[model samples]
Target: MTTAGLSWFTVDAVGAAAPPDTGPLLLDLGDFGSDRTELVGAKAANLARASYAGLPVLPGFVVTTHAAARVRRGEQLPEQALRTRWKQLSGNGTRALIVRSSSVAEDSATSSMAGRFDSVLDVRGWDGFLDAVRQVVGSADAVGSDAPIAVLVQPMSTAQLGGVLFGLDPLTGDRRRLFASVVAGLPEEIVSGAATGTSVVLSRGLGRALETVGPQVPGLTAGLRYRLAALARRTRSVFGSPQDMEWLVDADGVLRLLQSRPVTAAAVPPRHSRPLGTAPIAETFPDALSTLERDLWQRPLDEGIRAALELSGAASRAVLSRPLVHSFGGRLAVDLAAIGAAPGPRRSWLDLIDPRTGLRKLRAAWRIGRLRTAYPMLVEDLVDQVDEQ
Candidate 1:
């Protein structure tokens, strides 16, 4: 039973539905051409747009907000629609998928809403997929925004490296340059800001960018970095504005564009205040310190930072608390008001940090002369640390 005025795009296995029009609910990522912000939300719409543009996006389906709107009104989803899509994914059920929130409010020109929603990753099987979708949809309702929530399901990228890219540098606001933060595995860790990643800036020409701060992304070749920069340049050109995007570089070195949003640039902050460990002493440290966590004043600064990371369940808390770290010039996240009081650093991680410059950075963070007194709230932990010595 197909309806007039709307051509439904359904995949293999799941057939058509009943007399009562449930509306064309599901859309394949590739089939999206016109803007469907009302249905798929901003992030999904952009992904769909890119997919339709012949970019190398993961094969996926968009669960339109129409289903969500029905759920909102206490109405039932068209069972036929759900089952067909389920078979498309779960029939053979070999590939694990990712279920991410796609909210209307996300990725607007005004707000990136980067970590505000929920995403269930590495989901396998039909039951798991359904649960993940419900979880994401429930997350949207709990979030309570004017925008309805939709879900995007795609095969998870086992990318050897992943993270974020800014079509233009947020620090210098240079359209000719591109900025990126890269992680060894999934982009989630870096994007959510719990851990920093290797930082790269591709300049004009071959995109000659400085390491500026943070450890450089490992295994990410110069050729790949240049390609990513070139992709960002194309994205900006297509959108007619600067774009900040999430990306994945699979083990095969295939690149995938996850999401892109508009960005505005601003003046660079103080080196100590910057996210990358760029202070003079940091020059000799390993790349991990700058990318993931920079140490505080304590011995075994890595231990302290890890203690800090352990406190949070995942990236959400890290993203909120990392007043000390700043993602490069993509997001206008310059001010970090609470990093002064965050807990300990990780072990094995702090050894690389330079003691002198690190002290200076800590002194700046604590806003005090005596380094011992800086962590007043953490005084008890400090005492134990000293006793360990």
Candidate 2:
């Protein structure tokens, strides 16, 4: 079928005719070259390599940058013509398809415009499929410059459990740690950031999966890990920081690479030192009190106690600022002066007393101490002074 003098090539037509090399045009992942098909881009080249490596990739094709450019110049491919082509390509099967934006600038060694494009999933028929392909191709031209898209049509996998995995723990730059979140079904909902429920921590589970699959596939998991780690390492080496990666495991339990990008502000250093001691009393008073000083000290200790408690609270808040999903129902509360701030104090004249209104006095002391510890530098000098005196 032809739309406005441009012939719309169906998968069947391309398959039947088997267009010759036709100059030095890139054929697929196998034919990728830096010079010949720069427009095919890095992402397309990677997908091509993955397919060639005998990976369980869906059978589909790329709609070259050459075709994308034509569409950008107001030469619209008719939905009817595209539908006709799609029906021929899809054949007879209950298949859910995906149309992704494979731009040259997406997976580059340098900068990347990650998550800035559109991809449609679960498309069933030609009409919807063709429209989706065109939308992605067209989006390349809209306001974002001539961002040509290479459309990849892959058969969606029926997954029992799926989610995303990061090569390293984002919270702490701990390389030994691997973080993942598993949902009940296909990875789409999770990828789109719409999934709920607890995201499973994957260090132990992933370790087992890697140990089992690595030797069998030779370079399967190892290669993926190496490549992802290298990508992250190189990115951090260049920018002097770490990166965040996106990955998935299919229904057949084979891992697939989805995306990788630099993690913003993940490399920021900790602002203060961590809290000290365990028991509530120890936390409140790190040093033992002298009898003479204890009798003389009526409200000074309570004031210092309050300061320390406040510091601890502030520290907890700082740790929570970094992006992370804590296990649900985990308690993170800290009250450093709970014991000292109890009611009915002054049983003995020697007993240190704040003489404040109620339990509020004790709670206030605890918060102050927590905050002081939380911002170490801010109060460290003062602590030293008190210690010396």
Candidate 3:
């Protein structure tokens, strides 16, 4: 059985690294890639490639599958080798470490052995470290001898919050949506089915909140939402597939990539399946438009909205790069979700009390201030030109 609440895709060589010839007893996480999965295992290989591609990954080393295979055959662990690496990782002998399993069969495109092995967290001292390694290696017995397991050890992150992000909505298989679930402190509770996390769903293109569940978390800021959306998009671009990513936000608000794999099973909708609405737009047109009218007006309206989205910084260029207005049964409907057009600021005075939305509200206010400044100047120019004409 796969682990609960976590699913991810295997790597597809966005940046192929030649297998490091470094002896396989232990190696840096950056030393493996898709080409070295046999030696390092899928999880370690993915991390190495991601770090190489400039993603924010914690520095660490892997006790390679070669060593794990030997241990599985009832051989002793390379304790001296582990101690040397632990010194290098700990630096001060006080830093706690997290040990995770990276099985050769885990995170595979065909069969994601999601959390099928074991992980140890917040380990301290040599004795604890050795026990943690043994625990991780022993957990591999669940999958038997077929899948050799490598052990990954890294300095534990002092995370303020942690969760998982799906590059696409796993439930709906909607590629245009990003789904995330976050909880306070380490994400082990949420990943292990001990806690129900605050869930957030966003339009992938615009990073606009489509839905949010659970109480408003104090640090779940809109900027974080945008960043998560961008992270999902970038992972897909980097790995050539939609990914299930485990991430953490440290005390400093910096997001770090912890793990990533593909969504082995998901239902992807067709391009035309995007939900369309005619609420405010219907009020203006009210009925199906003639071909001549659609031909005459669609492009201009699309351009106007595109320009407005650009000016507001509410959406990215990629979101606004395409024509958003579409004809359905000769009636024009816009993908407001894609365009990120909302019914103006839905804010109450109570919003001032929440720190989470402060940056977003400030940005909105600043944009409004600029518009206020520019409108008068434009009107003055218009009046002057009218008199001259």
Q: Of the candidates shown, which would achieve the greatest lDDT relative to the real structure?
A: 3
Candidate 1: lDDT over CA atoms?
Answer: 0.66
The candidate 3 region of ten consecutive residues with least summed lDDT is 1-10
On lDDT, who's better, 1 or 3?
A: 3
Ordering by lDDT: 3, 1, 2
| Tens-digit lDDT track of model 3 for 31-145 | 6443378877888888888888788888999888867766666556666657778998977468999999988888866667776899998999888988888889889885564
Point out the worst 10-residue segment of candidate 2 by lDDT.
323-332
C-alpha lDDT (0 to 100) for residue 61 of candidate 3 = 91
Predicted structure 3: lDDT: 0.77
TM-score of 2: 0.49
Give the whole-model CA lDDT for all candidates, comma-separated.
0.66, 0.49, 0.77
Model 2, 1-389: lDDT tens per residue?
Answer: 34323455433333674222122211334444412234555455555554555433445555566556555654444445344445544663357777777786765535556556778877887667767778877767664756556665556666645555555554444555455555556556766778752343234223423212111222234444444444344434433444444445566666555544444443321333122222544454445545554444424544455444344432223333332211112211223213232111113453335343335446666777776778778688888999999
Which regions of candidate 2 deviate over 4 angstroms? Answer: 1-37, 52-56, 76-89, 92-94, 108-112, 200-389
**Poorest stretch of ten by lDDT in candidate 1:** 329-338
In candidate 1, residue 158 scores what lDDT?
83
lDDT of 1 by residue, 1-389 (tens): 44323334433234544233254567777663324877788888888777766777777787778766655554454556665666686445877789988888888776777778899999988778777877888876777776788888888778888888887666645556678888888899887777898788777446566554577666777687777877787777667887888888886878888887777323323333333333422444424334233323222443444444434322234444544333342211222223323212222445566474455455454544444575685887889899999
Q: Model 1 residue 155 lDDT?
A: 80
Which residue pairs collide in model 3, if any?
Answer: 8-261, 8-262, 9-261, 9-262
